[model samples]
Target: MDLHKLYHVHDFHSRNFLDTYFSSKPDTPFSHETLMYPMEKFHNAFSTGDIKGEVLIDISLGPIIHHLYSAQEYFRDIILLKPTDHCIIEVKKWINSRTGAFDWSHASTFVTEMAGKSDQCEEKEIGLRSAITHVVKYDPNQENVTAPIELPQADCLVLWGVLDVISKDLDDFVGNFRRFSKLLKPGRCLMYYGALNGSFFVVGGERFHIVKYNESNLRSILSDEGYVIRHLEVSQRIIESDLIDFDSVLFCTAYKEQKI
Candidate 1:
């Protein structure tokens, strides 16, 4: 790895991440886990120079905005949409990563935002003019409707973050996946990353239970939902200190199969 690149990456994390959230006052011992993997991948995509237009619809704050701020030329716009405002650390990540291109001319970018919980895409027509639109929504109750939740028709990449806690039952999760598959045309990719039900997490300063699913269960759910597994990335628990002891996290990308 180039030391210069690494240094910049570290600075982006420290100055932009820790300094903003943890504050530089008491020197809060903050670590980078959630944003590291995604940001590193973003850099990899840029290095290949194969990317064109990119639109990031982040669900877990806005780290994608941070990783590609000045380092990337592909993204024309970075819209900040949130379901809740508790995503302080995530917002900080965006602020730090957006140092460059903050004042760039986005008049022709065709980028915008939504400020509520549910993203009603299927009900509206945002057209297919954009290049990439990343969506992150995991709802079980609103299953198989095929309306309002359909994402924009662009070079789309839908992500399901924290899937384990989105629903009370596995069938609900599977149902949401099924409807999601219907919305996505064939050949597009969707990435789902979260801990299985056995996983633990801290939300609103309180620990709660999450629905767990192992690799086999995940495969079965996807297979039943009309998807073909294209790629898979799995990792052990990232933050397992005195605060939390979750088992692990899984990241998988699947394509909408041609056949139902």
Candidate 2:
């Protein structure tokens, strides 16, 4: 079966994913793993000041913007690249503050409190909304993912659970990574956050495929692609849920050393 075809047929539900993984449940192992862990990782990685940049290109798995709350403080402009219109529309809903948008106040509040500015939760959301300047569609199979538009080589590129979802195998993963690298300046940073050893995730009662790879596989791929790993962190799964099967989560920051 063509995985891409399955993807379109199932049609990823942005709201379903958000509610399933990022609900405002306090102290549940699921929330701790999916929500708090990623937020904390982003906050810690960006706080180092090594990832600061003028423009940040975000190619994530869905319309999720919770991870970008910390990044908005460092990057002047953010461009979101989505593979599906469903994801793009969901993003615009939040950005435009339209009706029925996924509520992200809980995420913003968590991020603000982490930074010791609990009073500025609304301010954080506003900053992130202002920073996201573009939400464009992209095809990972294309030589130029955002063809004809000719986006500038960004100072930083952030990938959150995108490669594994789009990649069918190791070769596909390598090719996709190379294509995404073209959007970043040489020696610039790439922040990656993805599930480790994940095979599939359920959304809206439909199962979607994901490439299964371990930390070593990821490290080797990055190295072969001329990326120098600066920081890498792995968190073990704390909750067992039938909605998804993954052993752990991996988050890392690497610099592209050689232009492709």
Candidate 3:
């Protein structure tokens, strides 16, 4: 990974994602209708009791604010686990409402609309801010990813957009899944989201690696590890030269009977 081209999630959002894939205008001006589909599915899952959880632990989240609108309402405490110092600092700055935090007002508004609310965008932000109870450093390389902090197993483990960038191969994916599984109590929920068929993405004019995989690989690995997929949703991105390099997005809700 070229250090210069690589950046945190917030940086990626500001640089390439915001206008190219998730533009404010999803109609005649631009098309981001595909990106919004997963958020809506997640929103509906949280709203309709499709995903049940008390404590939700987010693994390797690098300052992502796009999908938490409904998750904040569902989980009492959203613990964001950072795998690096830079990501940790960046996340805290936004969580603490420090200066120049990345703007997520548009995302908040979109989520609010998905939840059938016509207003109260500020309240939604406040609600999310309040729900974020802890920010802890996690080491993805370790067998126990969230080491040094002996936390009780969480009700749910959420892995989103991290596996592709972090995992080098199929084995790495399985290893990380096991590490995350250790954080979830037996029979607990697992919510996963990821970009499909993505090999690399540019951030701030720098390119970073993404381990491309198809639906078969994802479902096979998850099933092998004992997760029962209850709900699954996939969105195919419309191919465009200016748009981000991802073929599709996968969102799923599953539960583990026993960890492998």
Candidate 4:
């Protein structure tokens, strides 16, 4: 068992620690290669060709273009649906707080640097044409948005960080998906991440909780809502997680059932 596979879902403490652990455990599932396994799956999914006219939706777009481009390159077209620009502001503040310079930024700067690029990409290119589309407002309460914005009929959608906000109340949240599925074409796919266990703590006045649910339960809920499980990845946090807090995480993908 390789630890890389585990990292695909749960992150580890540190690269050095991971290297040492793997060096010692020739046969341990927690090997270094096993730790980074999830990334490979992610990369593979983004690298492999999928059907044409399929769209890829990424929920949180902070300035990570490499991964976005990878997905776009793999899927042909990609759209980023950000719940709020507040996330970008918060990210800016976080960077300023650590770096002591409001003059520098992350994703915003990346966007500026990559200005005028198209949002579409080709297989030979490993980058997004325009890279990201900011969803200024997200009405999780509704299936489609109230604003005059449109998303392509995504064959695949990446539900990255929105699960915590959307899954707050399972019944309502899942119901929202029921209505929202109409916005997508038949057989659209969604990829997402969630915590299997944990508590939501107050961070910057936003209500959040670590989503802890087993695959069986998650599948049951989504299945009842006309969704089917494609893949389930369980992961833990590495020592230096980008997340301010939390030690572990899990991710999964589900596809909307094609209409009868």
Candidate 5:
């Protein structure tokens, strides 16, 4: 059974996906891993003042923007690329402050508190919203993921839980990485977050396929693609769940040494 095909056939409910894994409450292990962990990593990485750039390209799974709360402070412009219309609409809804948009106050509060600016929670959300200048749809299979309108080479690229979901095999993963690299300027940064050794994750009770690979595989791929790894952190799963099966979470920040 082609799991990728099944993923396209099913309607990916953006709201359901959020409620399942990214609830405002961080009581569950799933929320901790998916929401707080990434938030903390991004906060720490950007705090170094190394990842700041003029334009940041975000290619993440679903309509999730919790991880970008800190990034907005560093990047002048943010462009989001979504694979599905469902995801795109959800993002636009939030950008427009439309009805039924996912409340990201919890994420904003977390980031503000981390920066010792708990009183600036609303200011953080406003900054993120203003920084996100564009939300475009992209096709992962294409040679130019954002074709037709050539985007300026970004100073930083964020690939969060996207490669594993789109890649069918190890080779495909490498190819996707190369394609994504073209969007970033040489000597810039690429911040990646993904599940390590993950095969599947359930959203709206529908299991979606993810390419399983270990830390060594990811490290080799990044090195082969001419990226210099600066920071790599992996945390073992705190709890087991029927919704998703994975050994650990990996957060990496690397610089593109040269054009891939």
Candidate 6:
């Protein structure tokens, strides 16, 4: 319900979103294991024998490209959609290769490292920049999130923390994802990442609320949305630290089942 609190410039740090989440700093809650889990699962699902296609649509990208490092290897075009101007501008800076763009270089190395590939951070940056052809502002309040701007149905949908955190309730969560699934081509794949049993997190010393959903609710919603689970994993917190307050994280790779 409180979507606007931590996203404002004063609360959110667009500059450090990547480094902050995927940190080498001492006792970063997003440990090497936490960061590596999704990447490894993605590598198995997609990098190994997963489907490939042209467009990858991302909503509420926040400021991290960590999820898309290996994905850029397969997707010819990546579209970054943001809910706010600040998020859009920050992502555009990196897309345009500006001088002070947030460094996503670490994402490339870490993603490739997870896949047992040699260091290719520079190549990874080039790949992402070249693949991401559009950085557009999306209005979620509209009947269609991409309204006033027509976008092709994507081959794959990438959602990280958007559906779970933005919706005010379970019904809102269901409706939001339903809209998102419409943007995906039928039978195409969807990759999702989000907090499990999390309601709020600290950013800039302020508390931000997130929708709390469990495994059963998530499965029911996905099934209602016509997704057939190809892979699913839940990683519980191995240790307690700081910055994040979620008990677990959900990683899912599924395909949109075609209507009969």
Worst 10 residues of 6 by lDDT: 2-11
lDDT by residue (tens digit), candidate 5, 184-231: 999999999999998888887778888889999999999999999999
**By lDDT, highest first, what's the ranking?**
5, 2, 6, 3, 4, 1
Q: Rank all candidate structures by their TM-score, best first, as comma-separated numbers.
A: 5, 2, 6, 3, 4, 1
TM-score of 6: 0.90
Candidate 2 lDDT at 157 equals 96
lDDT (10s digit) by residue, model 4, range 76-189: 556555444544443334223445322212222233234333332232132444433333345555547534666656666665444544454556546645645655667766
Quality of model 6 by C-alpha lDDT: 0.75
Candidate 3's displacement at residue 229, Å, is 0.6
Name the weakest run of 10 consecutive residues (lDDT summed) in model 2: 1-10
Global fold similarity of model 3 (TM-score): 0.85
Looking at candidate 5, the ten consecutive residues that score lowest on lDDT are 2-11
Return the number of clashes found in candidate 4.
Answer: 25
TM-score of each: 0.55, 0.94, 0.85, 0.59, 0.95, 0.90
Error of 6 at 34 (Å): 5.8
Give the runs in model 2 whose Cα sits over 4 Å from its true position.
Answer: 1-10, 26-29, 258-260
RMSD from true fold, candidate 3 = 3.5
Lowest summed lDDT over 10 consecutive residues: which window, candidate 1?
1-10
- Give the C-alpha lDDT of model 5: 0.88
Q: Which prediction has more favorable lDDT, 1 or 4?
A: 4
**Highest-TM-score candidate:** 5
Tell me model 4's lDDT, rounded to 2 decimals.
Answer: 0.46
* Tens digit per residue, CA lDDT, model 1, 112-152: 11112124322111222121133233333455332355544
Where model 6 places Cα greater than 4 Å from the true spot, the runs are 1-11, 32-34
